[model samples]
Target: MTRVRSLTAALSAALLLLSAAACGSDGDDTPKSVAPKTAALGTLTPGVIKVAVQPYSPYTSVQGDKIVGLDGDILHHVAKKLGLKVEPQVTDFAGMLAGVQSRRVDITIGGVAWSADRQKQGLFTDPPYYSPPAMAVRSGKTYKTVDDLKGLDLGTVEGYVWVKSIQAVPGAKLHAYPDANGVFDDLGAGRVDVGFLDPLIIIAAQKERPDLKISTQYLTPPTAAEVKAKPAYQYFQPYQTGFYLPKQATKLERAISTEIDAMYANGELTELVEKYGGDPEQFLRPDDAAAAARRGVDRPSDWTPPAIAK
Candidate 1:
C-alpha cells in the first residue's frame, strides 16, 4: 500500500511539470523580464516605443545620427512621460506607414492625416494639430488658390493627399516624385512651376537651402469640381495630423494619445508647433466641427478646439 501511494504522488508531480512547460512555450500573454519597466507600455520591444520615421524635413529629418524634427520632438516628450525611450527607424514615407501596420514598428510619424480609409488600416490618435496644404513657388511667385495652378507643371511627392486634386486640374500635369526632396529639387531647377507639399517640410527646406530662393503659400481649399473628382480633397482645409499606430496595440495607442492631450494642456504642443511647423494659430487649431466631419473625423456637434486653439 505504501509503494502504490508513492508512485501516485510521483505521477502527479510529473503532470504538473508538463503543464508548466506548455505554458512557458506560449509567450503571447506577456513580455519577459528583460525590461519590465517598459513592458507595461505593451511595446513589441521592452523599454522602447519604436517609431517609423522618414526624411521629410521638419517632421523626421536625421540630424547627425539623431532624429530631430517636430514629430520626433513631440514623441520624445510622450515617451518620457511613459518612462520609455524613443527609437526612430529611418525609412521612406510609404515604408513608415507599412512598418507600423506590419508590426515592424510601434508607431509612425511625419504628418499622417486623419482619413477614414486610413483609419480602417491602422489606429490614429486625436490630431496633434492642423495644417493647411502649401504650394512651393519661386521666391517672388505667389499662388493664392488651386486655380492659379492651371496649365502649370506641378511637382509633388507621390502618395500625398493632394495628388488626386492636382490631377483634377484641367490643364496641369502632376509630376510625381518618390520623395519631397525631389519635388523641391525640381522646383529649384525650374523643372516644375510649383511644388505641392507639406508646410513643415517646405519650411525646413527653406531653412536648409536659402540658396534655393523658394517660398510657400498656404493654399485655399480646392474647388468643388476638384473635390468631386477626388473625394479625399475635403481634408485640405487645414487638415488634422496624427500619429499612425499598429492596430494590435490599442493600449499603447491610448497611452500615447493621452500624453498628447496632456502636452496640449501643458503648452508643450503649442511651443513645439510654433518652433517647427510655424504659424501657431494655423497649425495649432483644427477646423470647425462641421468641416472636420467632412474630412472623416467623427467629432461631436458640441466639440470645441483644444487649449491651443486661436
Candidate 2:
C-alpha cells in the first residue's frame, strides 16, 4: 500500500508537470501571434501618407477633383508598397515647400528639382527624372540660344530657379507667372517674347498648341572659364527632379530612396515616365559621379536615376 501510494503521487506530479509545460508553450506563442507588426517608414498618420503637389502636368495635376499624373501615380505605387493610402493636396510651388517644411505633408512631388538651395531647405529622395532648361518662343520665331532672347521679355514661372537665370540676361525683361500654364499662355499671346521652362514642359506645351515652338537649344552650364569670366551664370546647370521631404525625415528619405532604386532596377520608374509621354532614357543619368564631377556639383551620385531594368 505504501509503494502504491508513492507511485500514484509520482504519476500525479508528472501529469501536473506536463500540463504546466503545455501551458507555458501556449503562452510563448500567444504573445507572438498577437504581437503587432512593425510599421513601415514615412507612415506619418498611421495608415495615411500625405503628399503635397503643384500643377505640373505629366508630373502632377488636378483633373476634376482627382489627382492624375506621373507623380501621383508614383506616389500611389509607393503608398501601396508600404500598405498605406495616399492623400494628395494640391498647392502652389511655394505652398508645397511650406507644407513639407511645416510637416503638414510628408512629401512634395511636382517637378521639384534637387539643388543646393533646395537641399538646405529640405531633404530629397533619389532623382525620379531629369529636365534641362529650354527656351520657347512664338511659332515661326528663331532662337538658336538663350542669348537670342536678350533685351526681350522672358516669361518664367515664379519661385523657379530659372527666374534668376532669366534675369541674368542683359535687358531680358523678367515676367514671372504663378505657374507654367500662365507662362505658356503669355508666350502664346505674345505677352512675352520668349519663355524659359523645363524641356518637358516645353514639349507638352508644343503638343497642346502648334502655335508655340520650342527651341532646339538648351541652356548649358557655364564652363569653368566661362564661370570665372561670368560669375553671374554660376547658378545655371542641369536639374534632377525628386520628392522633397522634411529635413528631419531621414528614415523617410531612406525609405523613398530605396523604393526609387528598386523601381529603377525593376523598370517601374521607366514605365511611369514612358506612360506619361516622356523618354525613359532622358531621365536616367549615364554616370552620375562623372556627371556631377564634370558639372562641379556636390549632388549625390548614388541618387541618380538608374538604367531601366531588364
Candidate 2 Cα misplacement greater than 4 A, ranges: 1-38, 63-66, 140-153, 178-182, 189-193, 213-217, 231-235, 286-310
Give the clashing pairs for model 1: none
> Which parts of model 1 are misplaced by more than 4 Å?
1-39, 62-66, 189-191, 223-226, 229-232, 289-307
Per-residue CA lDDT of candidate 1, range 9-71, in tens?
434543443343344323443333445545766887676676667676667776643567788
lDDT for model 1, please: 0.70
The whole-model lDDT of each prediction reads: 0.70, 0.64
lDDT by residue (273-304, candidate 2, tens digit) is 77765666556544343246324343454434
- Give the TM-score (vs. native) of candidate 2: 0.71
- What overall lDDT, based on C-alpha atoms, would model 2 receive against the true structure? 0.64
Name the weakest run of 10 consecutive residues (lDDT summed) in model 2: 29-38
Best by TM-score: 1
